[model samples]
Target: MFMEEVELFAVSALHNTATSPRLKELKVQQENDEVISRVLQYVRSGWPTYLPSHEILLRPYFECRSRLSTIDDILVLDSRIVIPHAERLAVLDKIHSGHLGITKCRSRAAQSVWWPNMSQQIAEMVKKCESCRKESNVQQPLSFVLSFLVVLGKN
Candidate 1:
């Protein structure tokens, strides 16, 4: 409770002191995010509560403790990464930058961050990304490649 209050105060100060409009706007959104606040509260209290659409994050769902930890009273996962559920889609957008394929996106997120069912979620998101689908390389069959090589050699 104390830590969350302090965080709120700091965020309030940050909003007031922000010099740029964009930064202040971003801070406002962060302050409003329920997922970030809930995680912080959970880490401080050491008790988990499942909310609507968040039942997957309950204790029994975790495969291992290696990826979970708390930093400065805020929940951290996968090497101290702070991933609020509300921000998952936004983060996914960044990780999928350059129109990465599913494997690349999965590997990228795996290295730095995690949440419940994170891998499955990332796969779905990558699959639905329009840019990635449009830009993905089409795989050529072995026969086609060999035939193309033979034709090139004859030419």
Candidate 2:
């Protein structure tokens, strides 16, 4: 029912492009994304029939109030991926590329992503943004000096 409609939406979003490796990666990754595959399978399977004896980390995912979802086969929390730990920085890079401040970045990311500490992660990244800091420091207008104005008046 709803899952079928979601699958249709995913399929429709895909397109064939001639030159973009990113497009290719996007096309493939959306459908076969494997980062959270095991957890998804558990949810899809209505599981816990047999937990692996040594597996411990599955607890958190199992308890997530946010349900797993997908768009074009890519796993998502809402519109954003419930990203794995290794890919968090990369995700931040994409979200913060415009050099936005903490609040703006957090708002933008909220549209597409979610995690337990998402806002904190955005704040940390914004703090470390050298380019944004440098740009802010360089763009102020200089005020006219009173002595220079007096000298010009004499001229």
Candidate 3:
């Protein structure tokens, strides 16, 4: 419960600072997420030996069951926040805000957030980004470009 209070305080502070307006919303959505709520219940109570077919949405998480946990009402995998479906686009925006390409964006996201198919999503997002497409080496083909000057004798 102490952690919950601290998280609430942090959210309040974030609100006051105007740093991240969406964080509070994320928490609310996380709490309201029926799937996550059930997952939390399972985590706190106990997971059954075998999940039935109806729980398809949760099947992805089952493999990493040991790493799932709760911080306040937010679900976390290992140390990374398990972003809900609704917030993934926003999170992706933040991840790609620097206009960094796919690899860097994936590395940045790996540090703090996660969701199923996140890598594929990131790739897709970057692929669809006009700016990224314009700047991509594939468009320019730098690899085949001749060197500006090939120095012949360098001992």
Candidate 4:
């Protein structure tokens, strides 16, 4: 009975986007066990199942107890999970591209269960990236002498 309820909920959630009248009616009447049972049986027979929500699957990856620590761990884990040398290279390439923001990279790294050193490693890697250095903003170094001079001039 529990399984049946779960199946019904899953089906209803999956088909929430469906537009057909029959589907709409089924969705409306979805609270009933008989309707759920029929849907479950139909799904079990041969009909295609709806794609599960990406948000549902990805929820755990983003739910970190400590954002900073978890993000670091994820990066290290990512290094291990991305097995193929080529895949690693590809990921590096993406990192090099401006398309992959720092936060996104860190989040992905955290998801991978990478070591604690992952965030530091990523920082070092970014620091050494010539392209980022060239394209990114360079902050002017602050000087006390400049500040003093500006104050004197104002006076």
Cα RMSD to the true fold for all candidates: 9.2, 10.1, 6.6, 17.4
User: Per-residue error at 138 for model 4, in Å?
Assistant: 5.8
lDDT of 3 by residue, 1-155 (tens): 22233344445443654424455566777778878777777877878889878998888787788889865556778767777777788788878877789999898787677788899999899989998877775555443343432333321
lDDT of 1 at 74: 37
Tell me how far the alpha carbon of residue 56 in candidate 4 is from the true structure, in angstroms, after superposition: 37
Ranking by lDDT, best first? 3, 2, 1, 4
Q: Per-residue lDDT for 12-128 in model 2, tens only? A: 444421323443354354335443566666655664755565545555555562576655445555445555555567777877888878888888777555555779988888888
What are the TM-scores, per candidate, against the unseen true structure? 0.53, 0.53, 0.73, 0.28
Q: After superposition, how far is residue 131 of candidate 3 from its true place, in Å?
A: 0.5
- lDDT for 123 (candidate 3): 89
lDDT of 4 at 78: 23
Q: Which candidate would rank higher by lDDT, 1 or 3?
A: 3
TM accuracy, model 1: 0.53
lDDT, residue 2, model 2? 23
lDDT of 3 at 138: 57
Task: Report how far residue 90 has shifted in candidate 2, in Å.
Answer: 2.3
Give the clash count for model 4: 10
Please report how far candidate 1 places residue 13 from its true position, in Å. 23
lDDT of each: 0.55, 0.59, 0.72, 0.39
